[model samples]
Target: MTNAEQPETPLDAVRALRAEFGIDAGRVDQIGRLLTGGDFRTVEEVVSLTGTSRRTVEAVFRALEPDLESSGDGRRVQEGRAAEYRCLFGAREPFGVRDPWTDDARRDPAAVAAMAGLIGAAPPPVQALDHVPATAETVVKRARFMLDGFDLTGAHVLFVGDHDLTSLGLFVAGGAPGLRASVVDVDERLLEFVGAEAARRGWDVRCHFADLRLGLPAALRESCELVFTDPPYTPEGVQLFVARGLQGLRDHRNGRVLLAYGFGERQPALGLAVQKALNPLHLAYEAMLPGFNRYAGAQAVGGAAALYVLRPTRRTAGAARAAADDTRTAMYTHGAQSVEASGGLDAQAAARVLELGADAGEKTLLVGDGWPADAPGRRIALPAFLGAPLPRNLQDHGTALVNLYPGFGASAVRALLAANAHRVGLVCRNDLPLLKDAEGQREFAGLVAPKFRIVRRLRDTPGPGQALVLAERAEPEGDAERVLGYMYARAHGKLGNAWREGLIAARKAAGTTLTKSEGRRAIEASASRPDLLERSLMELPLYLFAVLEGDVRRSVDALPG
Candidate 1:
């Protein structure tokens, strides 16, 4: 078997094809094998078999145009040339071959395209969060991997941060009958979008709002069988997201996590640091698929990401338990939240914030980091304050000094509503989006109206784009306000329980005697959506919150007067 005996063999042909077609040797090998398979094939069929893009297949056909016989919708090697071309292929399958997740990957290509369109139409990526949308192909491939690798039937998944919208991707590409998915994100726009879209699709996807730097909600912890995350590409970012993912697992022994990460090829040290961080996590690298993820942004990493399949080791439990209670916030690569960035709201402004909230006393808490030393009683890191089921200290604060600088209005709103502080002094840029205009202020004010009587304490306060917001707990004004306030006060509790008590108490205030059982009956018989009761107010979207309010108020009004 000398080289001369098998002159211009498959290896030589592969090289020749690579040179002549200007395609990579790997792609040349993939398309070469599929083209000479002794059957007519369309461009898509070849793509399906080879896992190459449509353009790559078309280029192959163009390079082989003179030798091939073409016909409608399919083409093949010319009559007697099949054997000649077939012998040019390598003995082994090429690198890109993968078991398709479903016939839909090829047979129903539009569904895949539709997924891309949906992501495009949704909100654009927010740079502050390190959001770079994954390519549609990557998203489809992810769903394929999910369905192909695990039994998603009746499986529970927690998407630790789903700005990628992988939750919808699963529904679009997979047919897992009982797949249960949940998404926890700090982005309200994304959460609201996902919530509405999932509802429209009649999906079992539930969205919970939480900034992972703090903690996961009690309801979401230990509730999923699979956790997937594409976190910011920093060591702290990787660990924090993965830690929250770990916390979401129902049972460590049976659960798994998928992590997407990328770094410039020259920056192997950065990648290594992230991988090293995983050692403390005690996770086995079940698999690593290089360049498995293609992104629309993040060009420094060549617009690609690696997909890591991870499984927990026996010793993963103790460290995972610690992560469940851990609160570390430096995760991003840019903005004030980035790994190297620090220093919270300006110190003098912080003092002003405390001064404005002075009546709150020493029991007051500070929510964010970098506050001047000796400025507070109890201090919660920005991320921890936003954690669901907030630290106990937050529940009993007197006057809390909150640093909401850099326009974290939505998060501040959610955090304050859940806190039982008598008054909260909000520190933020004067031009804060939620307070910049009357309309913005009015809308934001309405969202928190049930809890706080917010007043602009030091409007346009000088120095470092700062302003002070003084929020004092509001007393229930009317029978309706009482019902709303009672329910709002228990925002962290189960909605139905709060609604039931609030209804009975408010009706009693109106001089209407109603038994607890009667109030329950009133709700059961009214237009109230009972399912809303099962959700925590802290997790519910503002729109959904209004719906809950409407349901409760309507249920109360319908009560026998």
Candidate 2:
């Protein structure tokens, strides 16, 4: 192709090269960028630097043979054509010479450069979650801004949703190695990816799973000092994420929430609506840097966003607590929760779900978003049902009619496990992907297994788009099993309360009369904290859940026989 017809960006070139040469174009791009990056990178250095396989690096060298040269120590683009190769390879300085917020003191050049190279390795945006990946430069700038503007030393930092990998960028931009950083995300893939990178790099970052629409992780509430978020570009999404961020702070008055938001230039009203929504939370606008964030995509808003520095007024504590968005599903602007995402249950759908549980002949308890105005049973929001502490009276729960869909997303597994009743039936769209295939069904069953024996009695039964999943509680089979059942049955109650009661009951049933005091002491000696005591069992991240499970089993075994 003529020079005029050539691709403008290296990513464009990578796409063309891959289509033409059937090569690992992504690695080729990275290798090319490294070779012309003003440094002689040895094959080994390139592999170490980019996490590109050694074999792939050598293959790229062979492909770029005509443009390459070598010295005794390393490789580079031939000096005479170095500049030409640099452009073709997409090599560019991470920080432009004209930028003002950046300085060596605030961010390390090498760390930021390395971060830029690795940023693309993150998983692509999942639209249902309203993910929009930011440019590496934007990510680095955000980190720099935080460091220059705040006292993050030994601070508990939170990334409300880190599909952009800003948590990694923070450390790259000089965050302390011991900085207590936590990332909460609904995507299991993202949590695993971020956790793996943190572990491999020894960055001291923790990843937890939570769909903010459901609720923030119980352990994270009121525990962090600074929160950074890039939420869905919708008013409800912005408000919900900011509210959750505010809730995470140890004291709202002293903490800050760094937000990235933007709207189309032609849609000023949309921006104003979001700003008005923030007013209710009583946050003071500390700073507004327009066009501060640049994205890799999201061109509808001009491929850029604004950075907002928000400080919580003391009154923000109450406002933030009261700001949970009831229309959870409608927050995401695309995919499952797109335009038709209201999640308002019609009389027919709600009644269908109720009919499945009607055989139980028990009182109904409504859980989650949207039930008809006249639907039976008292209400507990899905978020509260899944994560908040609830009454411990398991006997009072006759039949639980839950909403497992619409805005619910991946929390469906945990939601089903959270509801305790002899029979629980939930309403969701007919095409719920989890029950569509054999593999998904098997996986779903495995997760909630031993707790509930689930069966999908209806998928498209009521009409063109509807499904019903019914589960019955399983019988506890062992001492440990019984204790787990005891605790889980009252999943709405305080974890410590249920555990203590279950431990004491387990010992008594095993021919020993362990007192509540003894059970409590044993649990505390096991390193259980008051925060853990107040949390619901279903509210913990999976790792913490496993840890608590082990703790409870040990407590049961420790009880005198």
Residue-by-residue lDDT tens digits, candidate 1, 1-561: 476644254344444556754544666666766767767788766654554555556766876665677678888767676676666656565754244443436565876797878898888888878998986767777887887788889988899898878888888885498888899998888988988898888888888887776677767888999999999998888988898898889879878999998775446798899999888989999988876777766766656677899999888867876765665546788866777776456677666666666664347777776477987577776655554456654566677777776545547677666667787777766765577788977877888888898876466653455667788888877766787798777777777777789888887787877788887887787644565667777777666767666776678677786
After superposition, the stretches of candidate 1 with alpha carbons farther than 4 Å from their true spots are 1-104, 360-373, 376-398, 406-410, 457-462, 525-529
Q: Which portions of model 2 show Cα errors greater than 4 Å?
A: 1-109, 113-121, 199-204, 325-327, 339-343, 369-376, 387-395, 430-433, 490-501, 513-536, 542-561
Model number with the top lDDT: 1
Model 1 TM-score, 2 decimals: 0.78
RMSD of each: 8.0, 10.0
CA error at residue 473 for candidate 1, angstroms: 2.1
**Residue pairs with backbone atoms closer than 3 Å in model 1 (clashes):** 214-383, 360-399
Write candidate 2's Cα lDDT for 256-358 as tens digits.
Answer: 9999998754468989989998999998999888667776656566566778999998789889878864545567788666645654567776777777665
